[model samples]
Target: MIVQLSDIELTARTLVMASQILVILLGFTIVYIAFQGYRRNRSRPMLFIAVGFTLIIGVQAISAGVYVVFDVSELAAGAVSQAAQLSGLICILYALRMEG
Candidate 1:
């Protein structure tokens, strides 16, 4: 039995999907923790962090929907990907603001 390159690529893609699912679950967990901290501490900064994570998750969810609707169009897919990247960057900046 010989394993071909295509089989390897397929396996990689499957692993990537699994990893993505794990990451999304982790993100939800973080969001939950942030929400709890915000509630307990009543800190404006923590609230901001929670909102940022919520925005990031919302953007990703919207992008996923866009991909489902426009999967056949490369342009549409690229636009959604770009939007997701931008939202993710904004989330990073928001997270960094905790230090400032």
Candidate 2:
């Protein structure tokens, strides 16, 4: 069966994809900066920040791709994405709490 999307729907999807790409790029840039800070200062918190950003941004995109490729339920994909985001938040929080 072939499915056709309306013009509005197609446009919305395109906008969403473009935004997601932008978010991913920004996330990578943040992680890169954090890693650079870590390398320059030898700060564990900066390393954690890098890892946290990667998990928060990269994992959700990866999970979304898996959902599309594997035909997973939306709920399952959302749960995975939420989990990754939560874990990332925790990492970021821990980084904030650490000294030096």
Best by TM-score: 2
Quality of model 2 by C-alpha lDDT:
0.95
Top candidate, metric lDDT: 2
Model 2 lDDT tens row, 1-100: 9999999999999999999999999999999999999999999999999999999999988998999899899999999899999999999999999998
Q: Write the per-residue lDDT of candidate 1 for residues 26-53, one digit (tens) a residue.
A: 7777778887987998865666666667
Which residue pairs does candidate 2 place in steric collision? none
* Candidate 1 positional error at 34, Å: 0.7
- Candidate lDDT (C-alpha), each: 0.71, 0.95
Provide the clashing-pair count of each candidate structure.
Answer: 0, 0
Those runs of model 2 whose alpha carbons end farther than 4 Å from true positions after fitting are none
Model 1 is weakest, by summed lDDT over 10 consecutive residues, at 91-100
Once fitted onto the true fold, the runs of candidate 1 whose alpha carbons sit more than 4 angstroms away are 1-5, 71-74, 77-81, 84-100
